[model samples]
Target: MNAAPPRVLTVAGSDSGGGAGIQADLKSMLANGVHGMSVLTAITAQNSLGVQGAWELPEEQVVAQFRSVVDDIGVDAVKTGMLASASMVRVVASLLRTLPADVPVVIDPVAVSKHGDKLLGADAMDAVRSEIVPLATVLTPNLTELGPVAGVELRGVDDRELAAKILLDAGASWVLVKGGHDEGPLSVDVLHGPGVREEFSSPRVDNRHTHGTGCTLASAIASYLARGYDVPAAVGAAKDYISGAVAAGFALGGGIGPVDHAWQFRDISHPGHPGRSKQE
Candidate 1:
């Protein structure tokens, strides 16, 4: 019998498009070498264009799914995406509190979709700040979400660290402020934590089909953490993985598509592919 691999759990919604929710998380975990499990919190009628409709699952169902996984299979790390309601956030946060203190929790503070669709319900941000943020081992929030989640309006790159500090003081052990939305030729992300502040930058891809980047990055971080990398190393590795995925993003429906979660496999199979190194 084969030994089990590192297990990472994703507590998130299901995207019918399979681009950016639990679907993306599982794909990223697989690419990063971990066994991924999920506790579905809601269902969305989503596609490459945008989310058409969404409905949060019952609270009991969410709790049951979580307990079924953590109590039996166990988890080395966890990643959270869209908890559609404030109640859902508290439920998941309460469940997370039951895990061993050592298990890393990567929180992707998702409030809006790539195509400008709102995902969180009223007062959900409050629940996230008061309950979830404090439990986070690493909080991954995009440029837009940073200010709102931390309750501050950022002026520019200069204020990113300040916003991150607010969340850090709120109790997240580490905070990664993503710069994917910044206007420039480079995509920059800042990871700040205890005695450490590091910047990761990659050339912005020219592709418009760059959906699922957040879910993928957060899951990749959790996967690496589950495989035993320290917080800094795990985040760095995730950045590299996401960079490749973003570069390989392809179009799906009429609107934006998704990042290639299997880009590493494609690189392995086709070493001579343009833009990818033979030794990658």
Candidate 2:
């Protein structure tokens, strides 16, 4: 048999809609050529319209899942999203502390859903600041999330840079301030780290089915990192992947749809599936 692929673990909730959360993360990992594992923290009754209901898993169960995965399979990289409560945040932070120092951890502070439903509790923000931020190899926060986590109102690029600095000083190795929510022609993501700052800009795709963009981006970064790409390179590659996924997004339900995680394979034919044809 051949050697196993790079391993990536996602500690997050489950999206019943199969748009964001663990579903998106695993798809991204597979697309990036990594073995994806999951430790589910919560489950949401969600769809293209919105999140209807959410239930957090027991804290002990969450811990047990993490231990089982890390102790046996082991992880080359980890990405976190949609931790439901303060207690959950604390539990995940403690679990992360047990990992080997070399493993990269991408933290996507998922506080709200694409449809404006709350995922993380308001009470959990403090725990995220005190416990989770420090352990991040790369903290991925969008404009709305950045405001609360960094305690600043993001008005422009300058504000975003300052907020990123605040996160960098808060013990995160790097902070990616995403500009997808901003009203602009280009979707620019700013990466700020120890003596390193770079802007990665891509033309904003005109698609509206961007339900899982954050989860996809962060998971792709972890997948690339597991495959041995450095931080900046991993993020750049992830941006490219997300851009294509967004462009190829399709309508799934009555409301907004999801990005196509398999966008790169649109033109490729599998054993049982035929490739797309030209205009009929």
Candidate 3:
């Protein structure tokens, strides 16, 4: 009999666009050779353009979904995205508290969508900080989210590192401050915690179809960690995976599309790209 694949569970919102949230998370996990599972916390009426509306699942339902999966299928690692309300955040945090301490939890403090649509409400910010953020094994927050989660404005690379440190102090074992919104020819992401800091640099791929980069990255990190990579190693592998996905991104639909989660398996028929064919 064949061994079962590594199991990865995503607790996040639903993106109707199928580019981010639970969709993207599961796609990333599968692409990285893990069996993916999800617990939907909210549902968004979203598309390529922006989010039109969002409805969070009731706290009881959310908890039941989580328990059903974790109690039976057994998640090797868990990744969390948008929790639309304070109550939802509190509920999810409480559930996390019940999990085994060694289970890796990758938290992507999703605040806004790729099109700048706010996914998290202001009223829920405090709850996120008090309940969710501290439970993360690694907290992945972009620049816009850094201020609220880390309680400081990040203006430069130095500021980003400082903010990551502060987030780690807040409770996360490690922090990855994504600098995708920063102004530079290169995108710089800093991972810092436990008195160790590592910087990852990649030339910015000028693509507007970069919708699910954050979700993909955090999920990839969780997937890799579930496969037994250390935090730094997991972050490094995920960074490389996202960079390649970004570089190979393609446009879809009418608005901003998503990164190709399966870029590593894409066919390269161009004559000059002989060795770049998709993997089976």
Candidate 4:
């Protein structure tokens, strides 16, 4: 008899291009050995080039999807992305509160795409900071979101520390200030809160095919958390996983491409955790 895989749920939008949003989240979950499930909050008409259009699901639909998954299938961890509006954020946040307090919730505060298209509306940024962020077990946000989240520009190592403290004071137990936007030889991610202050740095891979790094990293962290790793351990493992994915990214359309979610299976030379075995 086969044992059940650790289950992770993604509540996000659908990227028709299959490179980001729900597609990337589920792909990262599977790549990290989790049984992936999804509750799509929006759908986009998009491709490798860019997003042409997007439509948010009605509140009723979003609620129904969330219920359909958690009411029956259940979940070990949940990761949220592309919540298009304040109301949508509130709905998802409320539903997440229903889950047991122990179930880790990874919030990827996705604002813009690599092609510079807005995924989360400007008005919605307020919702993310006030309504959505407090529910975060692990809040992940890139520099673009720092101004709205902390009312300060997140730059330099000093700014990273200030911005982190502001968000921690707001609500999230842990804040992962993503440094992907920083121009430097090293991309450093800071995990800060409650007796934790560690930076995970990896040599920056010079590639434009990084369309889904945010979603993939957040989902990987959730997957590792479901596999029984502590918060610090989970973030560290996720950073390594995303670095490998970024290095292996391949061109898809005429525009930015995607991180190779299956890079682990493709490159066996790199060391990875055996206990978090690849899903067949």
Best by lDDT: 1
Instruction: Check candidate 2 and list the clashing pairs.
Output: none
Identify the leading candidate in terms of TM-score: 1
Tell me the tens digit of each residue's lDDT in model 4 across 1-280: 9998999999999999999999999999999999999999999998899999999999899899989989998999999999988889889988998999889999988888878888887788888888878888899988887767777875567887898898899899899988899988999998998988999999897778888999999999999999999899999999999998887788898999898898878645443322234432
In terms of lDDT, the poorest run of 10 residues in model 4 is: 271-280
- Poorly placed runs, candidate 4 (over 4 Å): 267-280
Q: State the displacement of the C-alpha of residue 215, model 4, in Å, after optimal TM-score superposition.
A: 0.2
Q: lDDT per model, in order?
A: 0.93, 0.92, 0.88, 0.89
- Residue lDDT tens for model 3, 1-280: 9999999999999998899999999999998889999999999998888999999898889989999998988988999999987888888899989888889999999999999989888888888877887899999998999888877876666776777777777788998888898887999998888978789999887788788999999999999999999999999999988988777767788988888887877667532222354431
Per-residue lDDT for 1-280 in model 1, tens only? 9999999999999999989999999999999999999999999999998999999999999999999999999999999999978899999999999999999999999999999999998689989999999999999999989998998988877788899999999999999989999888899999999988999999887889889999999999999999999999999999999998988888899999999898877745453232565456
Error of 1 at 270 (Å): 6.4
Instruction: Give residue 131's lDDT in candidate 3 (0 to 100).
Output: 85
- Model 3 residue 152 distance off true place after TM-score fit, in angstroms: 2.2
lDDT of 2 by residue, 1-280 (tens): 9999999999999999999999999999999999999999999999999999999999999999999999999999999999989999999999999999999999999999999999989899889988999999999999989988887888777888888998888899999988899878999998998899998998887779899999999999999999999999999999999887887788899998998899887654422112232222
The TM-score, computed over Cα atoms with residue i paired to residue i, of candidate 4 is 0.93
What C-alpha lDDT does candidate 2 achieve relative to the native structure? 0.92
- The whole-model C-alpha lDDT of candidate 3 against the native structure comes to 0.88
